[model samples]
Target chain A: MLPSSTSDKVFRSTLFVLGGSYVLLVVLLLVADLAYSSWGQLAELLGKPEIVHAIWLTLGTCTAAAVLSMLVAVPLGFVLARYRFRLKWLVDALVEIPVVLPPLVVGLSLLILFHLPVNGVKLEDWLRSNLGWSVTYAVPAVVLAQFAVAGAFAVRTMRVTFDQIHPRAELVALTLGCSQAQAFWRVALPQAWRGMIAAFTIAWARSLGEFGPILVFAGATRMRTEVLSTTVFLELSVGNLESAVAVSLLMVAVALVVLLVLRGLGVERRA
Target chain B: MIELKNISIVSGSFALRDVSLSLQHGEYVALMGRTGQGKTTILEAIAGLRMVTSGDILMDGRNVTRLAPAERGVGYVPQDLALFPTMTVRENVGFALKVRGVAKAERDARVHDVAEWLGISRLLDRRVTMLSGGEAQRTALGRALSFKPKVLLLDEPFSALDDETRQEMHALMVSVRTHTGVTVLHVTHNRAEATALADRVIQLEAGAIQ
Candidate 1:
């Protein structure tokens, strides 16, 4: 028998309550952020030269990291989605490690990776002596830290994007005299442009909010590698709640604008 | 001629066991089978989209079973038509030539000629997504024939068309075979489609030729 009218009403209400609770929590968080930081406070924080420099640093590093993410993610995602190979499960598991591992642990892991001895020489020392460069606690380290984690997110997104696409078009391209690479560029890559944009957007946002890894791998050096997240940290450590909250609000505003732009492009429907 | 010599293909739980088939040069043939039969599999094998466990695929009397899809020199239109969604009709039709680094002038000329042949000249500048079923079919056919491959493979080409469009495409198939003189292997479960398009009809039952 069908559910009774009263029970059906209760069930429908339960569904709304369950979904609405999550929405309510998100709205409450936004409202709390807005209420805690005032326009005057935001303007005051923006007037600081260090804060301004940090904003530029955030944009530069995030873009660099996100671009790097796509460079590796697109090919890795395509391979994972379309081809079968031995140890595929291992690769798949490795991709998810970043998304699930504690953020600070990713930072610690990078620090250890640089310091680990290989062939009786530390990697950071080898790099400094051979290439006249060092990765530990450097600007490059910031980008590397963000990419290590964000690239995994980008790869997962691209994998889903490629999975949704039919392989027949690519196969047909091959039949039409396109080599494998040509077919990917002409057929699969074009169709995947939206996903690429979405992937870039997500990677940028993820990189933007990265703090734990950047903190441990690239120390919070003023005027050197400080980003908005680090700015928030430094502001809070000095008991400057206003500047911290102001920076938090700024990050939220930037993230909101990005999501709105993605929505306007209508990629959220697919991605 | 297009030939499959004692080929076997194993895909998951399904297998085409020791299946052999042939189509003489310039011949228009239809492959018919039930839903679970391997009609599409056979077409994919010939197009080099799928691997055969044991057998030889030959086009113009040269073994191509070991060749990549691009090296096999066959044109394939899958059941869904598999038109490049990101390209315009002209680009889709001219894709093969463009990939081979053909000169733009020559590519445009051949694209125009193929579009004209398929009665899709008016649709060349249109996006692939904008075309009706019949228009899309013609565009796909134009694309397949643009490079003048040795053989053309069609899988369920009319399955998505309305009755009127299906009849129209049958006439287009006749013209395509006559104009190109390319070997044609059309796969379908519909006997009427086979009757309407094929000079010879082959049947498959559970991956074996009947």
Candidate 2:
């Protein structure tokens, strides 16, 4: 029983080697990209008011999208996971559509549909006049696009999280004079909090970096609905490589910090 | 008192055919079966987590087969003793009362009473994740008993504990039953647990009670 220490050592060494190599490859690419850009350009772009506005817009829209998605996705996910129903597979597939769909194609579809005429007037006008949302070339459009993709992701993640929680916990709560809603809030929700946090973080991060949808559906209008990614695109078109690099660097930093926070919360891995 | 009349269920790979059982008032019964015998399935069907293909579940002389779980008045503790790890012991114990819109003062009083009864008063502030297996089971039992349910269903309640903790939990169960007079329907793979706690034992094979 005490034998075979040598083989164990070899196996552990091999695992460490593989893990180290994978990490090194990603780190090396990041280092190379940073080295290619000058620090002065990165710093200059960081100080720009437009860049600040873009950062705020990106953060704001992403926060809204992620929060909205979670509000819808959590209950939907719980229902899908707990209940067996007709057309369940269809609902499940719909929740996962964004994972397989191309982001650019999704953006194009949103722009084409939203800009097209419905009955007589353009959807852009109807949205503003009827729905009270000035969606075209604005914050609403950006959020809509982000929500379209991120909502799907949140639903899928939340469904899995609900599945991981034991159904008995909910049953216990129900028997103890707790209503269904109360059981979910007090029992299931607390046990699955880590997963919800993780799902929200992922959706938020994805929305923050959304480029194709913002560029196509929302348009890259300066100081209007321009987000971090859109700002980078606008800078690139005008030959402002320094600003573009700077914005990109800022985005990377924010994402890294967020990722660290998520990890600290113990949601990143388990969720 | 609870009764199951001609219960039957068929999932993809498992089936329970014409299973009938009854638990008398304040009775302590244990359900025993080998793996793949649909022991948990029966419990789930009674709890409204599984839809019975055909059955009538009566609680206190009223048919509750079609009722939702929240309406059935059946407290359940599953095999894993799934406690909310993020919540404190007080929150966990007070959850059912809180959900029923009980006043905060009343909820706290109930929580304190239950915690004392379960000998978990000192652990009111501990995260469930930090509790020992015995402690967790007590907390789970406290959660079930806090609202004074008519029947308590425990699935393999002591399967995860060491021998010492298992004995401790068995003693605690006896104490709980003695003090509260709550009917207990326990399911266990371990024979000793059934022998120790069950006033009656129902042996299940292939989803039918023997």
Candidate 3:
């Protein structure tokens, strides 16, 4: 048998190198494959007006969804992190259901909800007539589907962030002549700025990669609801593999650039 | 004057039971106890951070049992200081006044005055995370004092300081009390600290004052 110290060292070193290399290798391989496939087609894809429009649509809708998610997540996360009430576990589970549910299921459920009759009136028809907007197979559906899943991630991140903060900060603010709202806005929310950035970034990135829900709920209509992910899927279905790879590479480049910018701006999650 | 009449609090497995104490106006009282003996709990109870299950808290003969912490007009410096790390020292010190919608000129003036008094005038532009232990404590004290609270609750305000710094903080506390005449309730486990800072030292055992 090996000496206890030597065996322990070996075990740790082996696991560390193996685990570290595994993650790095996967990412490197994916990027390399995309680069190789799209080497000549990237410029062509970029030149296409439809592809350019899809990229812009993805950026816009993802940003809107991420911001909307944060607006919902902040208060919900604060309540979950700070307060105690009846069936709090139930509420927590409900918030998390979207995270665990299949993306396709989320799309189907939302589609079903919009179709359901409310008070003897069809919900979709009522919304279209009253608000002059359509949800199914529309641009709004893309945002809604992205929000359904991405908002769950935002909530989870925010909850963890608020949980890390000492509640005494808010309490101290209160004792220092701040009303509840004042204490939250001044003390608690300021403390959560890094977390807010993290949540927004995670939700935005998740929204960018979202495919199943967007495709199922909002059909891939060119220059309308088609995002980069949908663009990739459409190109692949048309047997244009190089075009698909080009769009995928664009997504990877954007994600890397945005993350670098955020990090450069000193928005980081503290332990 | 502040009074806790038969105050009791139960938080999870730890509890403070039937705690009663009274401090005269402008009095500096130190609460001493072993760890887990509810010294901090008592201070929190008085600061309105914890709800007493069955007791009345009175301040200046007014029952403030159900009043929120802000309305209670108390200044609290918790054990860890709880400085808003994201804000500059000036902002942290001026937060109470800012939340009250005090004008920019007045708020800046008051923050400057408090920072000067705390010997933290030079550190006002620095972030709270950038300060040393003593500086953070001074900034926290300045923040608590910004609103000119009638009562001040300090939980081991000097526990993390070195010997020389702790001595300086003790002197600062004495000066603050003399100048402002704010009632002080300090919680500390160190007997010498309690003896050095308090007008009357109260010993706590199993949540009761002895």
Candidate 4:
């Protein structure tokens, strides 16, 4: 029999290679399938007005949702990272619920939330009548849904980022005649640049891929609430496999670009 | 003068009970203790970084225990220096002046003067990440001094340096105290460091001063 050490090494190497190859295989297959099926229709799909509009809508809403998420996430993240308080566990769980819940459930929950009465007022109907704003089956609902889910991811990323920073830096800044706000803005915020970038990108990418919530809350109306993910779903529902495949390819491309940009930024930061 | 009157602070498993200490104005006092003996805790209490469980802190005859760290007119140099990595040495040194909305010319002049005084004028343009341990210490000192604080708190500022560098830092600290006339509370575990630098050395065991 072989030595135990040699057997252990062989076993570990085999497991590692298998695990690595499995991940590589899944990604390769996805790309290959999209490219093979959508090759002929890709040009036509790109030129279509509805497709082009959906792409722009996806980009615009994702950007808006990402920015909105960050505006809230920064303070929430800082508090969660630095402070200890009663019900902190509950707050943390609430923040992460969206991330854990199925995308369909999140979408359904948002749809249900809009219909609920708030202090004797039906929020969805009241907004529609008073502010001329409709949420259910509307464009704004797309962004709202995206924000609900993507914001959670942003908060998680930022919290980890803030936690990594040395709290002494802020204390030192405060002792240097800086108010708490000044200390946070000048020291903590600057130190958290990498985390902010990562959070924004994660949120943006998540919003870009968000489909289930948008479909239920914001109906996939062509050129209105249509995004890349919804475009694929809508096309496939109508037996338009080529169009669905093309949209899938577009999404893959966008995700690839985002990953590449994130890597590039990481490299730049290190340099 | 800086005074901690019967301060009691409890943080998780570590506690400092009735830790009272005082430093005369322009006097450099060193707090020496074993590791985890609450030397830093007392310094933090004076700097308003820690909330005291009881008692008060007075700075220049003013009860500043309830004041915010920014309002306390205290400058702190943590053990790691905690220099703003993204900022150049000039920006790091001039952070306080900038925060107070001082004019560009005045801030620049003040930053340069402190940098020159700390012998880090040549390092002004360099990013803090590029600095060596000694340079980072001086940058932290210059930043703290730029605020013209009523009291300066140094937490083992020279503990990380070599003997030669530590000696240089001790000399620098002496000159700084003489020029600025700022009351200082320095925390360290090194008896040699405390003896070399402080006007009075307070020994701490457990939590209270021995």
Expressed as tens digits, the lDDT of each residue in A122-234 for candidate 4 is 88999999999988887899999999999999999999999999888898898888888888999999889889989998999999989899999999999789989999999
lDDT of 4 by residue, B62-88 (tens): 999999988888889999999998899
Off by over 4 Å in 3: A1-16, A31-39, A267-271
Interface RMSD of each: 0.7, 2.0, 1.0, 0.9
lDDT of 3 by residue, B1-210 (tens): 999998888989988888889999999999888999988888787788888888889999999998888788899999999999878999999998988889999999999999988999999999899999999999999999998999999999899889999999999999999879999999888889889889999999867899
Assess candidate 4 and give its lDDT.
0.89
TM-score of chain B of 1: 0.98
CAPRI class of candidate 3: high
* Candidate order, TM-score descending: 4, 1, 3, 2
Q: Report the number of the highest-DockQ candidate.
A: 1
Q: Which candidate do you rate higher for TM-score, 1 or 4?
A: 4
lDDT of 1 by residue, A1-271 (tens): 5657988989988999999999999999889889988999998888988888888888889989999999999999999999999999999999999999988999999999999998889989999999999788888999998999999999999999999999989999999888889889889998998888889889989999999999999999888889899999998999998788899888888777866786667555443
What TM-score against the true fold does each predicted structure earn?
Answer: 0.93, 0.88, 0.93, 0.94
* Chain B TM-score for candidate 3: 0.98
* Residue-level lDDT tens digits of model 2 in B4-72: 999999898777999999999999999998988988888888887778889788889999888888787
Off by over 4 Å in 1: A1-24, A258-271
Deviation in Å, model 2, residue A94 alpha carbon: 2.9
All candidates: CA RMSD in angstroms?
Answer: 3.2, 3.3, 3.2, 3.2
Docking category of candidate 2: medium
Ranking by lDDT: 1, 3, 4, 2
Q: Residue A257 error for model 2, in Å?
A: 4.0
Question: Backbone clashes in each candidate structure, one number apiece?
Answer: 0, 0, 0, 0
